[model samples]
Target: MEIDEKDERIDKIDQILNDEIDIDVNQEGEEAEFSSLQDKYQINSGEALNSSDIYRIAAKESTRMIVLVGPVASGKTTMETSLYQLFQNSPVNDFCFAGSYSLQGFEQRAFYTRIKSKGNEPTTQRTSLEDNQAFLHIRLWNRNNNVISNLILADISGEAFTNHIGQVDEAKISFPFIERADYVVGIIDGEKLCNKKTRNSIVSEMIEMIRTFWDAELITDGCVLQIVFSKFDLFSKVENHNLILEKIKQQIVARLSELFMDIEYYNVAAMPSTIDEFSVGYGLEDLLQGWVRKHVRKSSRKMEEPFDELTEYDRLYYKFLGELNE
Candidate 1:
């Protein structure tokens, strides 16, 4: 009965999520491009989708603008890299534009990467991201068939988030392509969750920024927010997985629920830096893992581990975020 009920829920989810978002169909190169992709990647049967299928569908039909928002060193870039790969390695083709930039005097940077099936990879060589003057730029097409394209993962520095109130006006400044986003990726720092005062502070600030953005009308789609609790490597090494998941969710439900009328949250951990291999974890019920340790006052801790469970977590995170609209 449990399995049956779960299956029923999944079906309802599928029905609500099968169609692409109601985008501005009139935008130049938008409808024609998506229509071209739909022609090639349309699903025909009731068979459930595999990871590859999810990647393919997202690659072809995803014409949405995405932005990554989180604390400094919260692994936004890593998540972005993995998500790009999750789509790229899938049987479905996805395209990405690596050209990213930043405005001077502003601590933040802007990048434009199109998320679509493999269409064509950018040919030009790009400069390193650390070179404040240079941006990590490339325009890639990862689709061989129909192609769906939209900008991905571009933003300013953590200071853009840190110096919020003092620089709130500058925060409103065009930091990146986020001024009009269809998707907002919020990466949460796990170790921070263990700390009570810090956790609440972190959550409050994020909620405020999001509220500020929404009220300001800078976003094209405030409907979806993909809240990712990244750096699970340190989290599991310190506490029990089940307990951690529940607490994490509760924190999110308490703090972030106000940001959106509908929301989806995911606890994600990337490959442990200690491990030479790559992995991911997803779908754990968030339980408060434990009280913050007396020794670790730092918000983020780098821990070593023998790992398993970290691949496909963040993308599945995206899959569920899409569920919010349902």
Candidate 2:
């Protein structure tokens, strides 16, 4: 009876989720420009997607963007690299690999952090803010609905986030991308979660970041915020996972619960534990699954109004301000 009840609940949730999200899966792969990159290495067409490229993509009928926001060394790039590797090497349970406009972009970023790299020592270089508008694009074919979804992921600099936390205008000046994001992936270093001092600072920074978003009017009632505790493997070695998690919920979530209409949390390692290489990417699959569900659901629903894009005037104004600073 218990098993039956559990199954029933799962079915109900699936039904509700499907109703809320309109995702149509691709029945068969199409022969198009995207097909050429199936070889992964013989990339004839690919380039780093800049702000204009992403803006053009988003301007299309159904394109969704997921922006990563966190401090440096918070595993934003690691998570991204891991996701691409997973999609490339192996297919997620139900989702099939479609094609990416930025295949070479994914390969370039994912190359350094490849799990099979020499020495097996985790080596992830700090993501340099080369281009503020640049992003890695991943397109997936959702098996559930057979819908093709374009996903835009960004690795914004920690310094950029730090600069704008308490200051709205500063955030506006630095983070024009935030205003156009559909989801904000807030990454917290798991090692910090184990330390009381760092934990306190993390929550404060998170609160301030949210406040900046609120002040800028970047957050809408429908916008989703997903907080990921990265490097969970590190935390497990020193502290009780449940205890630290509960403390974060009590301290961080409790304080900022009212700000977001929808929120979720996950603990991911993104790589194998230092102790052993047996279990790699502990909670990444769950994170990606949740992300897929949210993406598809939002894509299916028609918005009451379209979102505003960053205009030429805004760009010219920022450029002018930069010249004045120089």
Candidate 3:
């Protein structure tokens, strides 16, 4: 009888062990399902995106590409970061900051300028030519039309273009994205413009950069050219600021009038040295407004159906390309 009881107890223990094994398997199955769901709904990685990444976003949205062209220390990155910083406080030119895929990228660039950095003066980190990603993206919501638009700003290192000053063929090979850009912004350094020594050379270099791009056919007639003077507050401090600005404008117009259909000029002090005198992001609202206005006009046009043979990404790209050409 004792031996029979022992065998019965052993059988009961096996049964409990089997039940625990079943529970463990069920838990693992549930965990696997949760992981699958997480993969399906993964969020943006919050880093600067590459061409493939931007193409993916463009495929699903109405996208506009803005390429900032300038030499080093010309305030290209500053303008971008200032625009992002502006949205943190309030809407800019009626466009609310809807979202950004590159929050970390913008934040990293803007951090040094913030008071938290413990710096004596606000300074922007220079973009390197060797950086893997060149594009930073933001989604803006227009309060007037209740429409959302995607803006992809190319933050390529200024050295990329400055290095290939007269090398049109090399520039063409390197900057293929310029062909697809809706707006090509040429940044003028206001601090350099203020100085008598570097002023003429700075202007000439800018003009030549544009000319090189035009010769390469990278900046076709479809792209709008925006001549932006960055750090305008410093330039304004100089005597005869108005006359200087007019002369510069006349020079640019005389040189580039035939190349582009629309050319606009803006003066922005993204981060002014004299904060008491000039506000941060001075004149940036007008810049934002100009872009939004153009976007609205483009969106109003009728879109033709994309060719069936093209892939989804190609279809979207070509569709926008056609619109810009028109």
Kindly list the per-residue Cα lDDT of model 1 for residues 1-326, writing each as its tens digit.
99998887566545535764443445555445565566678643422222233334346544344466766766665544444334334332234333222112111211222223332521111222233331111134445443434333343355455555334455566443455455566767776766656766776666666655655555543446667677665666665656756776676677656555445566665434444332532322121111000111111112222223324664344344443121
Predict model 1's lDDT versus the native.
Answer: 0.46
Candidate 1 residue spans exceeding 4 A from truth? 1-62, 84-147, 165-168, 194-197, 220-222, 274-326
TM-score of each: 0.47, 0.71, 0.79
lDDT of all the models against the reference?
0.46, 0.69, 0.85
Q: Is candidate 2 or 3 superior in TM-score? A: 3
> Best candidate, lDDT-wise?
3
Q: Write the per-residue lDDT of candidate 2 for residues 1-326, one digit (tens) a residue.
A: 99998887567547645676332343233222233343445533565577777876677636667777788778887887778778766778777778777787667666666556664566565666656435888778878787877778876777677777788877776667776777887888887877877887986787678768877877654567888888888877764778767777776667666776567888888875563832566687887777667432222122232224436675454344332121
> Which candidate, 1 or 2, would have the higher lDDT against the true structure?
2
How many steric overlaps are in each model, in order?
A: 43, 7, 0
Query: Residues 137-248, candidate 3, lDDT per residue (tens digit)?
Result: 9999999899988989999898887998989999898898888788889999999998999998999999999899988988755678899999998999899998998999
After superposition, which runs of candidate 3 have C-alpha atoms over 4 Å from their true positions?
1-40, 295-326
Ranking by lDDT: 3, 2, 1
